[model samples]
Target: MQLPESQVAVLEAASADEATSIDALAEATDLPPETVTGAAFELEEEGLVEVSERVDETIELTDEGHEYATDGLPEVALYEAALEAGADEEPVSMGQVIGQSGLEGDAVDIALSNYARKGYGSIDSGEITADPDAEPTADAEANALEALADGAVGTDDDLEEVIDQLERRGLLEVVETTTRDVALTDEGVTELMGGIETTETVGAVTPDLLTSGEWETVEFADYNVEADAEDVESGTVHVLRQMSERVKDVLVGMGFQEMDGPHVDADFWINDCLFMPQDHPARTHWDRFAMEEPSHIDELPDQLVADVERVHREGLGEDSEGYHSPWDEEFARALALRGHTTSLSTRYLSGEEIGEIEPPARFFSVEKAYRNDTLDATHLLEFYQIEGWVMAEDLSVRDLMGTFEEFYAQFGIEDIQFKPHYNPYTEPSFELFGTHPTTGELIEIGNSGIFREEMLEPLGVDCDVMAWGLALERLAMLTTGAEDIRDLHGTLADLEFLRNAEVTY
Candidate 1:
C-alpha cells in the first residue's frame, strides 16, 4: 500500500511486542520531533497505531531553591553559626547569630522559625542556642534540592514530602507532564508484512514549480483530512454592543429615525421641558450628578424659556392648571448628567436644531444615561436607555399600545401586560410589563403614555405625541436570562456569560 514517508517511518519504528515513546520513534526515524508527532497522530487515526498517554508529576528547583542547594538553607546557616559561637555552652544573642548567618529582613524570621521547628536550635530570653546533640549534615530538604538540581524527581514518596515542604517555602515547584507512547496495531503489522511502498510526494506547490510548468508532472501530497488544523480565532463584536445594534435595527425597520444628544445636558431639556417642576425630588443633589465646568447653559432660546416659565407658573391654556409654583430660570439653566435619553426627545420635539417638526415622524434614541444610584446586583450608576416618541395627528391611547405590541414582537415576546401609571409628562401613562420565562413573574420593562399639553405646548408640538422611556439593560437581562444587571455590564461582568450569550433578534 502507498503511504507518506513520515507515516511509514513511524509505523516501522513502533513494535507489536513493545510500545515505544514518540520521542524514541523520532530518533529511530531521524525525523524532527514535530514531524514525528504529526505522523504518529495521523497513523493512530487511521487505525494503524495506538497512542497511549501517561501523566507524571515531577519536582524542579526554582532560582531560590538552587541558591539554597548551593549555599545551604537559611535555617541551616543559622544553626551552623550558633554552634560555631559555642551557644551549646552559653546562650548567644539572637542578633549576633542572625548577623553571622547573613540573613536579612523576613528571611531572619524564616530562619529562626524553621531552625526551632527542625530542633536544630532554640531561642529563649532573646538568646539563641544550638541543640546539644545537633550535627552539621544535609537534611531531607537539602537532599531533595540536590536531587532536583541533577534531574526531575518522579513519584518518590520520601522525596515527595520533602518537595512539598520546599514548595511551601517557595523554593521549588511541582509540574505534571504527559508522555505519549505509540505502538503498532494489528492492521499496522499486517500492512508491514504485505510490504509498503514510500513514494516521493510534493509537499507544497511553489512559485518556481508553476513558472517551470512542472506542476502537472509532479505527484502532489494528498491532504490529510484527519490531521489537526491550526486554531483560527476571528474577531467578534462585543455582545452588549451587538445587542444595542440589534435594537437600532429593529427600530429602523419600523420606520424610526435615530436621535442623539449630550450625556451632559442642561436641566431645561432634561426636566423643565418634560413638565417636571424645578423643586421636584429628582432634581435634588443626591439623585442627580451636577457638573461644575460649563456650569449652566446660556444658549437656550429666550422665547422657549419664557413659555416654559409661564406654563409652570400658570396653565398652558384654559384646559389645564399649572403647578402654580415659583419658576427659577437659574435652576433650568443648571447643567447635570442626564438621567435619561428623553432629553434628546425633548430637544427634537422642540425643533431646536432638528428643524420644523412635522406630523407622522417617529424618533428614537438608544444612548447611555447616568444617575447617582447605589450599585447592587440589579442597579448600575450608568446604563443605556431606549427613549422614543411618535408624533402624529389625532393619535389615541390605542395607537400607543399597538406601537408597543409591534415593537416587542420583534423580540419573540408575545404576552405583554400594561398597568395604569402616572407621570407628569404623559396623561394616560402606563407601566409595561412582560412575564419572566423562568419565574413567571411580571417584570416592568418600560413606561409610556401620550404627551400632556403642558409639556408639548412649550416645545411648540401641536399634535398628539406618544412617548416612552425604557431601560435597555432590563431588556437585555430578559433576553439573555441574566439574573443580575452587574453580570451584564460592570466590573463584575461574567466573562463566561458574555462569551456564551447568543444574540437574539
Candidate 2:
C-alpha cells in the first residue's frame, strides 16, 4: 500500500541516521510514533529495508527504497505539479486532460472551470487558453441587469427607479413622496462623549459617595430612606444528616432513648438471637460477607445460650416450634460487619434490664449498615437505616400502624398501605408501602410488626416490642430524584443540592 507522505519522509530519515527506535526516528523526522513504526514495517516487508531486533529495533532502507527516496518527489507529486502548471498557463481541456492524466474525472472538470472563471484561462472551443482576459464586471450586478432588461423587475429598488422614470415621462403619476433625516448637533456630540454633568443644589444636601444611593434611586421618584423594610434569613439544615437527626428527634420526642452499637458484631446477636434459622437462605455466602478471620465467641454466657437454645428447640409459648438444628456456636461467634441496624436493637434487648423497663420502653437507632447486595438505581450495598422499636405490655399492631402514619405525615407521606410479609423474627409482620406521587405505584418502604416471643424470649424480653425501619437510600432517591446508588456517596453530596432542594412538609 502507498504510505502517507509523512511516513515516507520518516523512512528516509531512519535509513540515513541508522535510527534504532521508532521514537528516535519520529523525533528526527518530526512524525508520529505510529506513522514511523508502520512505515518501517512496510519498508521491511517490501524488501526495501532489513529490520533487526537489537537492544533497540533497527531499520535500514534497501537499495530500491534508497533510489526512490533520492528522487525529487513521488509520482503523485509529479502529477500534482503538472496539473497546477497546466491550470496556470492554459485552461486545459477538461475531457482530454482527465483522460491523459488519469486523475479524478470530477477534479479535472472543477479545476478547469474554476481557473477559467478566475481569468487564469478560458475554455474556448473545448480547449483552454492562458490569455482569456475576462471582463471585471461583478457577477451579481450583471445578473441583476440582465433580469431587469428582460422585464423581470429584478428587485424593489429597481422597480421603484423604473416607476420614478415612468412618472417623469408622464407614463405614471406619483401619489406622494416623503424623505427625512436626523443628525446630532455639536452639543449632543459633546454630551455623548463626556456625559452632561449639570447639577442642581438640593437644599445643600451632601452626596453619600460611600453608599449605593444613586443606583438605588427610582427614575422619577424622590429617595425615601425612612421606608420600613423587613430582613429574612434563609434557614436550613444538613439534608442527609439532618433527615437522620430529624427522625431521631421525632423518636426522642415520642420518649424513645437513642441506642448505639459497634459497626461489627457476631452473627449470634444479629441473626441467631433473632431466631433466624441456621440454614436460612439469608445466611448464605451470597447474601452475607463472612469474615475471613472470624472472631469466635467461645465462652458466651451459659445463661444466654441456654435461654436461646430452649427458645429455639421448644415453642417458647408465643410461636410454633423453632428449627431443631443444633446451633453452630462456632459460626455464631464469627465476627461480621453489621448487615442491618436491627442488630443494634437485638444488642439492646440482650441486656439484663430489658424486661424491667417501663411498660413502653422506646428505643431508636440511626447508623450505617453493610450488605453484599448489587449496586443499582434503588439499592445500595452500604447505607443508613432509620430504625426504632417500642416495647409495651399493651402495644398492639394497630398502635405500630398509627405511629408510622403520624411519622410519615411529617414528610407529606399521608397515604400508606400494608401487605402481609414474613420476617423470621417478627410474627404477623407487614411490609410498609407508600404511594409515589408521580407514578402512583406503591413502593415498599420497609417492614414492621410486634416481635415474636420466640425472638424476644431468647433475650429475656417478655413484652411485645414493635419495630419498624426504612432504608435511607430509598428515601434519598425519592427526595432527590437520583437514580444511581453510588451517587449518594462522596463528592456528589454537594452543599448546593442540600440547601436549595425543595422539601415538602
Candidate 3:
C-alpha cells in the first residue's frame, strides 16, 4: 500500500495495542506534531488507525498567587493577626488587625471579602472576630495555591473545590490543552505487514501543476477541516454600531430625516438654544467636556445669538420671564464636546445647519456624545444617544408619551413607565424607565418632553416641537438582557457576549 511519507512515518510509530499521544508520535517519527496529527486523522478516516482525544488541564500560580504562596493568603494573614489581637475571644478593631496583618490597598478588601466566606470570622461595624476553631494552616484555597506554586498539578480529589476557588479569586490560571492519541486497528496491522511504500501526494496545486496535463493523473491529499489552526477575529460591525444603524432605520421608517453635525460643537447650539442655563451645573467641568485650545467659537449667527441671549436674560413675553442669571455670548460660543446629540436638533431648528425646517418635520440622529462621568456598569464616558425631535402645529405631552410608547414597542419592550421629570428645554418632561430582565430593577432608559418656547423661539421655530434624547446602550440592555452597558462597548466590554449577542431589535 502506498501512502504519504508523513502517514507512513506516523503508522510506523503508532502501536496496535497502546494508544500513543501526538507528542510521542512526533518524537518517534521526528516530525512536527501538527503534521503527525493531520496524517493520523487521515489514517483514522481510512480505517487503518483509530484516533481519540482528551483534554489535559494544567494549573499554574499567577504572580499574586505566588506571592500569597510565599507570604500566606491575605485572609489567612488577617485571621492570624486577629487571633494575635485577641479577636478569637472578643471583637477587635478591624484597623488594628489589618494594620498588624500588613494587608494594604486592594488586599485588605480581598481579605475581608473572603474572611467571612471561609468561616474564618465575622466582620461587623469596623470590628472583626476570629473563630478559635478555624484552622489557618489547613485553608484549602491556600493549600491549593501553594501546591500550584510548587509546580504540583493539585489533582487530588479533595483539592478540586479549593482549586476552583483559587481560580475564581484570580490566584491561578488553568490552561486546558487538547491532546490527540492514536492507535492502530487490525486493518493497519495487515497494511504494515504487507509493507508500505511512499507516494508523492499534492497538498495544493501550483500554476505549473495546473498547466501540466500530468496533473490529471497526480494523487491529491484530502483536506482535513478539523485541523487545528490559528484563530482569526475577522472584522464585523460592532453591536453598538449595528444598534445605531437600526435606530436610524427605525426613525426613518417613522418619517424622520437623518441629521448630522460635528461631534465637537459650540455650546451656543448645544445648550443656549435648548434654554439650558449658561450657569447650569451640567455646563460645569463636572458634567461637560470643555475644549481648551481656541476656547471660544469664531463665528455664530449674530441674530440667533442675540435672540437666545435676549430670551435668556429678559422676558420673552408679558407672562413669561427669562432666567435673571448673567448670560454671556463668549460663554455660549465656547467650544466643547457635545454632551448630547440634541445639539443637532437645536442647530437644525435654528436654520443654521439646514434651512428653516418646516412644521410637521421630524429629524433624528444616532451619534456619540461625550461627558465627564465615572465609569460604571450602567454608564460610560462616551455613548450613543438617539436624538430626535418633531415639529408640528400642535404638540402636547400626550403626543410625546404616545411617541415613546410606539418607539419602545418595536424593540419588544412593553410596560414602559413614565415618571414626571425636569429638563431645561422641555416642560412636562418625563423620564423613561424599563424593568431589567435579569436584575428585576427599574432602570431609566431615556428622557423626553415637548420643546418649550424658551428653547424653540430663539431658534425661529414657531411650531410646537417635541424632542427627546434616548440612550442607545440602555435600549440594547432592555432588548438583549445585557446587565452592563460596558458589555456593549468600551475597554471592559465582554468579547464573548459581543460576538454571540443576537441583535434582534
Candidate 4:
C-alpha cells in the first residue's frame, strides 16, 4: 500500500466507476500531466490501477475563421448588399452592388466567386442579380465557423462536412492527440475503503530543502528497479558507424595500422597509381563522379608521374607490356571524389604519405567513397570502403585466401566463396561473396588481388603486395541483418530498425 506521492495522488484522483483523463488528474492533483502519466503507468504495473489510451482529434478555428465568424463571410456580405441594391427584383450594375458590399481587394473576388457557387446570386454583363429565395443566415460554412469558434460542434454530419470544407479552405487546423485515461482497479478501491494514507515523501533533495533541514525529516523517493526508461536515440551510435569502429578495432588487432587520406583526390592516386588505364571504361563519365570547379589537382610528384606514364606507354622491364593505349597526364591530374578508399592504400604504399615502409607492413583505411552507381537494395551514391593492403616477401594467392578466411571467421562468416576475376591492375584477382542469411542469395562483398609489377614498380615496392577493397555497408548488412543498404543509411532509413539494431554474428 506504500508508494510515491505522485502515484498516491493519481490513485486518489482516479475513479473506480469511470476513467479519468491524465490531464484531468493532473489538474486535480496540481502536478504535470507527464508526471501523472508516469505514475499511472507504475500504478498500473502494480495492479492497483489501469491506464488506457485513445486517439482523439480536436477541430478548432483559425484566425481567419474567427474573423469571418465576427465580420460575416465575404459572400454573405456581398449577397446582402445585392439585395439592398434592389438586385433581387431586377439587374443592378455590378460596380454599384460591389460598392455597397464594402468588401475590398481579395475579399471582393472571394464574394463574387462563392456568391454564384452557393446559388445566392449571379453576375452577367456587368450586372448582378440576387435570388429572392436565398437565405444568407443558413450558410453551412459560416455556421460551421461560428460553431468551431464557440466550441459547440457536436456529432452532426452536416456540420462536420462543413468543417472539412473549411479546413480545405485553410481556415482551421485539426489536431490529433493521444489522450490517456486512468481508472482504479479492485485493489485500489479496497485500499481506499481501508483508509489510504498520504505519505509526505520528497522526490529529490533540493538545495532549499537541504538548507532548511527538511531533507533529514522527509523520505526521499526510491528508484524503480524495473527495466523501464525513455528511449534515447540521439545518444546511440549509428549502426553503420558502430560497425566501422568495430572493423577498425578488428583490423588493428590483426596487426594493421590505419591510413588517412582525402575523400576528394586526383585521379593519379585513384586510378593511374593503381595502373588502371586512361582508356578504361570505368574511368569514363559512366562510373566516376568528375569534379567541375577546380577540376585539376595543383601538384603531383614529377618523377613518380613519369614512372607511372613510362609503365603505361611501354612495357615494364621486358616481360609485361603495359596498357600501351594512351597516357594522358592531364587526365591523371583531374580531381574527383574517390570511387574507393584504395587511393589511401596507393598513397601509403608509394611512401608519399608517412615516409617509406619496410617489408612486413600492414595498413588499412575505413572511409567514404563516391560512385555514380544505379541505386538499388545494395547500391548507394556514396558508401564506405574498407581498404587494406599487406606487404611482405614471397606472397601468393594462398596467403590471400588464408587471410580472408581468418578475417571473415571473426564475424562468424565461415563460408567465403572467392571467384576468379580480371582486373587491369592485378594479375590474378578474385571477387569475394557471402551467402545472405535472410535471402539465401550469394552477395559480392569485396575484391582482392596481388599487386601487379606494372602498379608496384612505379611505386618502388619491389616485394609482393596483396590488397583488397571491401564494401563496409555489405559487411554491416551481413552482421546486422539489414536487407537494404538504404535501410542502414540515407533519408529513408527505418527509425525503428535503427533504434533496435544490434550487430551480431
Candidate 5:
C-alpha cells in the first residue's frame, strides 16, 4: 500500500514487537511531535498501526529549580558564603552576606530562613553566623534537582520525599501529560517487509489546481475518515440577543412599528406623563436609580407641560379625577434612568414625531430599563422591557385580551388567564398570566389596561389606547425552557444552558 512520507516514516520507526511512544517515534523519524501524532492517527485509521494513550505524571524542574541546579541550593550557597565571611569569630551582616552570595530578591530571604532551619547557621538581629563544625555537603533537595536536570524524574520512595520538600519550596512542579504509544499491526509489519513506497500525493485540492484541471492528473491522498480533528468554535449571536431579535420579528409581524427612545429621560416622560403622582411610592429613592450627571431636563414644550400638570392637579374631562394631591413641574423634569420602556411609548404618543395617530396605530419598544432592585432568581437591576400600546377610535377590554392571545400564540403559549388588577393609570386593569409549560404553575406575564383619560389626554392621544409592559427576560425564559430566571440571563446565568439553548417557538 502507498502512503505519505510522514505516515511511512512513523510506520518504520514504530515496532511490531514492542510499544513505542510518539516521542520516541518522532526522535527516530526526525519529525515534529505534532506531525508524528498526526501520522500515527492516520496509520491507525488505515489498520496498519494502533495508538494507545496513557496519562503520565511527570516531575520536572521549575524556574527556581533550574536556577538552583546551576548554582548551589539557596541555603548551601548562604552557608558557604557565611563560612568564608567569618571564621566563627565575628557575625556577618545579613546585607553583606546576601551581597557576597550573589543572590537577589526573595532568594535572599529563602536562603537565610532555610540556612537557619537546616542547622547550618543562626540569624540574629541582622547578622548571620555559620555553625563551626557544619560541613558543606549537597542536601537531598540538591540531589533531586540534579536527577531532574536532564528532564522528568520518576517518582520513587526516596525521590518522593525529596519531591515533597522541593514542591513545598516551589522549586519543582508535577504535571499530568497524556502520552501516546504507537505500535505497528501485523498488516503494517507485512507492508514494511514488502518494502513500503512513498508517493507525492495531494492532501487538499487548491483553487488553482481545480481551475487548471490539474487535480484529475494528480494522485490524491486517501482520506482517513476516522482521524482526529481539531475542535471548531464558530461565532454565534449571544442567546439573549438572539431572543431579542426574535421578539422584534414577532412584533413587526403583528403589524407593530418599532419605537426607540433614550435610556435616560426626564420624569415628565417616564412617570409624570403616565399619571404617576409626584409622591407615588414607586418614585421614592429606594425604588429608582437616580442619575447624578446631566441632573435634569428643561426642554419640555410649555403647553404639554401645562396639560400634564393640569391632569395631575385637577382632572381630565368629567369622568377623570386626577391625583388631586400636588403636581410639580420641577420634579417632572428631574433626570433618571428610565424604570420602564413605556417612557418611549409616552414620548411617541405625546410628540408629533410619530405624526397624527389615526385608528389602529400600534407602537412597540423592546428596550432596556433600570431599577434599584436586588439581584436574585427573579429580579435583576437592569433588563429589557417589552412596552407597547395600541390606539383606536373605539376599543374594549375584549380587544386587549384578543391582542395578547394573538401575540403569545406566536410563541406557542396557548393557555392564558386574566385577573382583575389595579394600577394608577389603567381604569380597568388586569394582570396577564400564562401557565408554565414545564412547572404547570401560572406565572404572571404582564399588566395591561385601557389607558385612563387622565393619562392619555396629557399625551394628546384622544382615542382609546391600551398599553402593557412585560419583561423580555421572562419571555426568553419560557422560550429557552429555563427553570430559574437567573439561568436565562444574569451574572449567574448557566453557561452550559446558553451554549446548548435552541430558542423554541
Candidate 6:
C-alpha cells in the first residue's frame, strides 16, 4: 500500500517529546487535511504510529510501542514464546498468551497454535502448552475425533500417536471417567520460548539495524484488529424523525402548544367520548393492541361521560338518531395501545384546562401509534403520526388543506390531491394523496377535516376544530427512496448504503 509522504513523515517525526495534530502535520507536510488524515490512518494500521481522536488526528504511541519502533522483536520468536507460555500453564487462553508474550493480538492466536503443533506447544480451547512431552492432541486430531463421534469415520496412526503421547505425559486425564482433559507441563513453556529465540536468530531484523545510515524501509503485514472504521459523512436523521421534527417545528412556529400523552389509553377517551359504540368493529383484536393491565378508566369526568352517553343514544343532530345501545362502561374502560396521536388531542380537549383556554387554541403531537396489521412494504405495526388541531371560530377546511400543502412542500412534494372520504369524527373529511416522483403513482398520504359537532360538542370545543395527520414512515420511505421500511434502519455495517442515499430536501 502506497502511503502519502506526509504520513511517512508523521511516522518518523512521532516522538516522546512532541505530538502533532493531522492539521499541523498537513500544514508542515504540504498535504490536504483529508489526505493527511487518511495517511495517518494508513500508517496507524501498519503499526508504525498510533492515531487518537480522528477529529484532530493526534499521533502518539504507548511506551512499549515506542520500544517496538527502535528494537522490534522477531515474529517467529514472538509466536513460539506465546505458544510455549500458553502451553506451560493450565492452557492459558489465547488472549492471555498474547498479553504475556508481547505479541500483537491479531494472528498471534493462529500463529501460537501452529507453533504448538510444530512441537513448540499445544493449543486447546484458546489455552497453550509448550511441554514437548505434553500429550496435547493436535487441533486436527481433536476435531477429527469430535467429527467421528458426530457420525463421521476417520482415523490416522499419527492421531493415535499424539493421543498416546498425551496419555504418557499424564497431560490427558479422564474427567468423571467420561471426557479427557489436556494439561501442559513446565518444560513446554521453556521449549516454546526457546523456539522464539531460535527463530529470531535466523534473520528476523533487517541488516540496517547493525549498520544504519539513514536507511528507509517499509514493513507489510496483515492481521485482524478490532478497530472501528473511520466515520464517514452521512445525512442526519431518519426520514420519519426528520418529518416528525419538521411537523413539530411547523406546529410550534404556528403558535400551537405541543401535548404529550401515554401510548396506552383507555377505550373511553379513544372511542366512547368520540361517540364510537363499545361494540364498534375497531375494538376487535384485528384493529388494536388491547392491554391486559390497567384495563379500566377509573376517573372519567361524570359530565363528559353523561354527554357522551347522550351523543351515543341520540345522534347529536348529525344523524336523526344514535344507535341507542346501552353504553358498555366496562368496555369503554378497557385499556389499549393508542391507535393514533389524536387520542392526545381528544384528551386535551376533554379536560377543564381546554375549556378555560382562549378562543382559537391550537395543539399538536408527534407520537408512535400502535396497530395490529400484517407487515407489508407500506405498513408497520408501530409508526409515527403528525397530528395537529386548530380550534378557532374561523378555522375552515381550506385552512387544513393549506397546512397540509405547506408541510408536505417542506419535503419537496409539490403536487397534492384530495378526495372526499368518510370519517365518523370529521365533517367533509378528505383523504390526501401525493404523487410519487419516481413511480408517478398517487399514494394516500393522510386524512384531514374539520371536527364534526358530534365529536367535539361534548368536549366543549364550540368552534370549528380542523385537524390533519399522516404517518411519518410513509414520508420517510418516499423521501429516502427506501423500498423496504426496514432499510431505513440498516442491519449491516455498510455505511455506503446510507452515504449514497439521496435526500431531496
Scored by TM-score, the top model is: 3
Q: Which of the predicted structures, 1 or 3, would earn the higher lDDT when compared with the native?
A: 3
Q: Which stretches of candidate 6 lie over 4 Å from their true place?
A: 1-236, 352-355, 489-505
lDDT of 3 by residue, 287-348 (tens): 78889996888999999889999989885788778889999888999999999999898888
Assess the local accuracy of residue 504 in candidate 4 as a C-alpha lDDT between 0 and 100. Answer: 56
Q: Give the worst 10-residue stretch by lDDT in candidate 5.
A: 372-381
Best of the two (4, 5) by TM-score: 4
Model 6 per-residue lDDT tens digits across residues 73-136: 2233444565566455556665566676666643343344236444555545434556645333
Clashes of 3: 0
RMSD of each: 16.8, 32.9, 8.4, 17.3, 17.6, 23.5
Cα lDDT tens digits, model 2, 11-86, are: 4454423435666677877888765665555455445444454342222333322332343112222233435456
lDDT of each: 0.84, 0.60, 0.86, 0.87, 0.82, 0.62
Candidate ranking under TM-score, highest first, comes to 3, 4, 5, 1, 6, 2
Steric clash pairs (candidate 3): none
Worst window of 10 by summed lDDT in candidate 2: 176-185
lDDT of 4 by residue, 1-505 (tens): 6777888889989999999999999999999999998889888888999889999898877787789988989989989999999999999988898899899976775677578878998876568899999988899998878877888887778777877667755578788999999999999899877876666778777899978998888887665778468766576889988888888888998999999999889999999999899988788764798999989999999999999999988858778787769889999999999999989988888899988999999999899999865455788879999998899999999999998898888888898999999988886899999988888888999999999999999998999999999998999888778887878888557667888888653
- 2 or 5: which has the higher lDDT? 5
What lDDT would candidate 2 get against the real structure?
Answer: 0.60
Ranking by lDDT: 4, 3, 1, 5, 6, 2
- The number of clashing residue pairs in each candidate reads 0, 2, 0, 0, 0, 10
Candidate 2 Cα deviation (angstroms), residue 228: 28
Which scores higher on lDDT, 5 or 6?
5
Give the Cα error of residue 326 in candidate 6, in Å.
Answer: 3.9
Hey, what RMSD does candidate 4 come out at? 17.3
The candidate that wins on lDDT is 4
